[model samples]
Target: MTELNDQALLRYSRHILLPEIDIEGQTRLLNARALIVGAGGLGSPVALYLASAGVGTLTVVDDDVVELTNLQRQIAHDSASLGHGKAESAARRMRAMNPDIRVVPLAERLEGARLAELVAAHDLVLDCSDNFATRHAVNRAAVVARVPLVSGAAVRFSGQLAVFDPRVETSPCYHCLFPEEGEATDGPCATFGVLSPLVGVIGSLQAVEAVKLLAGIGPSLGRLTLYDALSGDIRQMRVPRDPGCPVCGERR
Candidate 1:
């Protein structure tokens, strides 16, 4: 971990004050690198909090441009950013919030070996993409690279959050919980309207998990959390590693 200057020390004083995250943890945070997938609804809050928390380097990947419809839930982009790339829009906001950190904005969608290579370079990854294809691809990459993954998804009135650390022997991969073809579904926000705040709730949790992982404190949520906005209720389900699963099964 690099040394924190007077300004950095003051900037992250709040995090430093915590018993669980003193100067040592704050230093770790200041030196950590995080990769965030997607820059729309879920990516907005995740990028915001991680940047504000002083994560040293952030790589944001997305291929979509900011449309007027995205303004409703994606807080990172505003009216001025309409038609701009989501990755670039979010990266600008992250730099604006904290110039101390470095933010890389990639306007291309990553897949195959490119995706896995990117995952290997980061200390942690946040999967905030909207589609199952991106999410599953991220899971496979994380599993192969042995990187920790913080995943979140929100649709309509429902939200889900989970922390999957591939370095852990017993933790389950995203593919383990939702098999490739069997559990996949097409529920984009365009098809079924999503409540705006639901994404914030889940995305914020993704930031929490990322910080905990980087700081080396707090209990990792090995279980999946289900949030129902309309019912105002939450449920936790255990995610056991599947020996028969393809992604992490071979590792076991």
Candidate 2:
């Protein structure tokens, strides 16, 4: 592990002071590579926090452009970013927050071999996309690369978060929890009228899980966290790997 410089030590003093993190864990974060598969609501906090925490390299992917409606929840972009690509916009904010880290912005929709290659290159992947197709695609790539994945979603007043570490023998992949064949009606926040800050709540948790996984801390694997913004309730449930799962199952 590379030794933290004087400036780095000062910038990350709070994390370095934590016994769970300390200098060693902070160093791990400095050397970590994270891939965030969205640049909207959830992706905003995930990218910003990971950058501020000193993740060495961050790759943010999104093909959409910032629109007037996104300003309410996508904190990474501002009015000046209107019409700009979401990935590039988010990258600019992340870079402004932490110039010590490297941010790569891919302004394109990822899938198939390209997606698999990207996931293989990263130490961790965060699924912040709104669609079921993207979630399943990212999960498949993470499973193939044996990379840990932090998945989060928010719509209306409901939000959910989960950590799937393919590195863990007993940890469940996203496919095991939400099979692709059973995908329900899904749409963007514009369709469901999501409450502002709901995505922030879930995305921040995703960032926490990503940092823990990168720093070798105990991550919330094999469980799903649910947040009900309406009732202000949080709950968690254990999720088990499926032996017949097509993505990460014994059959495969």
**lDDT for each of the candidates?**
0.92, 0.93
Model 2 agreement with the true structure over 211-242: per-residue lDDT tens digits: 99998899988989999999999999999899
Question: On residues 74-166, what C-alpha lDDT tens digit does candidate 1 reach at each position?
Answer: 999999999999999999999999999999999999999999999999999999998888899999999999999999999999999999988
Off by over 4 Å in 2: none
Report the error of model 2 at residue 62, Å.
0.7
lDDT for position 134 in model 2: 94
Give me the candidate number with maximum lDDT.
2
Ten-residue stretch with the least lDDT total in model 2: 243-252
Instruction: Show where candidate 1 strays beyond 4 Å.
Output: none
